[model samples]
Target: MLDDEARRALSRWTVGEPNAIREYAHGAINQTWLIETARGSYAFRRCAQGGAEVVRQNHRLIGEAVARGVPTVAPVVVEDGNTVVVESGRVYALFPFAAGVQVDRDRLSNNDIQAMGRSLADVLEALRGCDRSLVKEGRYEVCVSEAIREIDRLLSVISELPPGEPSDENALERLTTRRAWLVEHGVEDGDPFADFDRQPIHGEFQDRNLFLGDGKVSCIIDWDNASWSPPEWEVAPFLDFVAAYDKVKVAAFLAGYRARCKLPDERLDACVWAYGLYRAHDLWLFREVYDRRNDKARRFLTPGRFKPHFERWLRR
Candidate 1:
């Protein structure tokens, strides 16, 4: 997928000419490639948005994290002595190739799940004393109001689906059932945001972003979503995701997490409430928000892809 112009632009950051480039298959936000050169191999990332400044901030954050003993990938400074390089109207960054395997929640063993929790704690601890002001304010998570709007919009779309078709009929029934369940029980009893501890947390610490080497966490990648927020704001969704996949491993993860920080049951319950509402909102919007404009949205909207997850979340 590398055109001559793109290859030339990327060569600027390499030790020598780029001998080969292979695109990594599983990402939506950015295009990643394994770049090989006479000198060595590097991970090349082309960010589609946020420009150079965002990339620079990510570089700085990762650097700070690395210095604090957190396993992470910091960008390798290019020839210009900057972590980010502008090339052909796009922003690119080069990183040293970190060998590891990215395990999904379904495939995670008891030990792997526990390690994930500890690694997540490590990330939180490493970021504890840093200048919180340096991190961005707004989170990438869907806003409460936005989630409501998306749910309503998705319901409308479902209603418009042609009747009598087996697949559409089944989808309609499922959406209606989920919408009713969420409307009835998804709202939290009280606002957890009234007064809560806010700090810089890994905004998106999902399974795919975590890398494992041997038996321990080799590194955590994709710092693009780093932001300052209530710890519950991030942890709540994470717990739900982990629970959805494998509830048996939840205790191991919690044990690992508690080894570093205290997560009281009351506080975690409140976080779960908040996360439930957020997930309910994302259920409909995940597919409807972008329609066909975004490929991820389309894939999510396709029957059996995301609806099942939403259904499971609602059932809980």
Candidate 2:
């Protein structure tokens, strides 16, 4: 349900009363709302603080993708011809609602994985030259150094924490353990593919972000972290995500991906190891920071969850 201020803020974007302002409580960062009006239903999202520029760039990029016949839930232009609307110092964007269901791991078959792969390849191709202004931090370039410094900072905080706060101490210990694991695995080593082919990738191209309708991908949503990256950087993560459930399904996905786009064999091998380390580092960061702040963050922190996943993939 929406409060009075939220109702007023949303009314500016729609022609009629903003009825059915139901919250879509899936994402961790943004506040999403499903709104219905006399005109049409829309997915309205209040972006996180300091995300206005990212939203603007996404609006531009998604619009370009739609022009190229890609299936994307692009943001709608308000009365002022702006995709983003700032009201009460908060930035919001209204997207034309895509009627589809998000596929879960249990429901994902080889064919579904193939469809996902094909659609993602099409999206990556369509996103070329959309925007060159905002560059997302590449995993190999920043993730390790940043995660290392953050772990040290968190350990300091844990030391200062009042004694007998066993839960806090445990969480911080987990963080340190992950940091050591990453360092032992040579995460801070120099990048092998420093000059790899780079382009804009759907930063969070995973199952939850894809919308399926009529046995096909209807739309790709949430372009918050769209930025320049290597094909392997994005492809490896998507493969890792699907492979977590079943390896056979991942092979089908790779077949579909290769049919549409050429993923260099060497790049894929190196990037998988790089991304595995990055995921290991990132999951621990999520655990340390959000342990007390939000319980949902625990889902990413299941006691060295990505350890074996990284170890196996990196060694291969």
Candidate 3:
């Protein structure tokens, strides 16, 4: 529920009187509320992690993206000529409600996937042209020792927990399998993308962040994770999304992206490997479910979600 101080802060903008406010059930990090007002509906979000400066930086990137014809929701400016408001030690921002539906990965058609590919390329290219000074250099490499330690800690914790739901068993099995795989084949020596160029990329460009309508992408939301990284790092996830490693779908997505930006053929394999390693080392879902006991993160866990990426990496 929204507090009084936060509600009062809405008056600083000309979005009109709020009639209804409901918090969105999804999202792992930020607290987002749908506010229906007299003038129009808007999305009010509280920065759960970074402070006002982060919000301001995101707005600058979004502004640059909009100028380049990217389909994304821009933040609404308040009376004081700012896109963010700080009230009660919290950072908040408002955006006009984006009209579209979020489609799951399984339901997406080839056309939809191609549209997503094109949109993501546009976003990456737009951000690439922005002043590089706006963002800090993002990490493309991972520490194998730290990942091994974390996996060991998680395995120990899971072993001690009382017998619980089927999901707990699922987590235990998956973690054990991952531990063995990591031990045998984890990158320990060289930098992953030492030769590739880095640019601003939407770090999290998965299906959930995209909105679709009439089989086309209407908007690309959620810019909080935007940062500077190799362009292939952004394209790797889409390659994984193509069902059964279908070459046609992969070609369509690559063609769409190539129309807007350049992706060398030689770099394709490396891109896939980069994304594979990322998923291999990622333990956030486990930490959230087993450590923090967050129910929302549990939905992301599926049988063998991490194994496919590892297998892909092995094949490459």
lDDT of 2 at 122: 84
Estimated TM-score for each candidate = 0.81, 0.85, 0.88
Q: Which digits, one per residue and each the tens of the lDDT, describe model 2 over residues 202-297?
A: 788888788888877888888777778776666777776666624577687888888899877676676776666556656444543444465544
Residue-level lDDT of model 1, residues 258-299, one tens digit each, is 887889988766666555545555553346333543453333
Candidate 3 TM-score, C-alpha based: 0.88
Q: What RMSD does each model have against the real structure?
A: 4.1, 3.3, 2.7
- Give a tens-digit lDDT track for model 3, residues 196-276: 788888777777888988766788888887877887877876677543356766776777788877778767777777667
Scored against the true structure, residue 190 in model 2 reaches a CA lDDT of 55
Comparing 2 and 3 by lDDT, which wins?
Answer: 3
lDDT of 2 at 36: 85
Q: Under the 3 Å rule for N, CA and C atoms, how many clashes does model 3 have?
A: 0
List candidate 1 segments past 4 Å from native. Answer: 139-148, 152-194, 243-245, 283-292, 301-316
Q: What is the C-alpha lDDT of each candidate?
A: 0.69, 0.71, 0.78
Per-candidate clashes come to 0, 0, 0
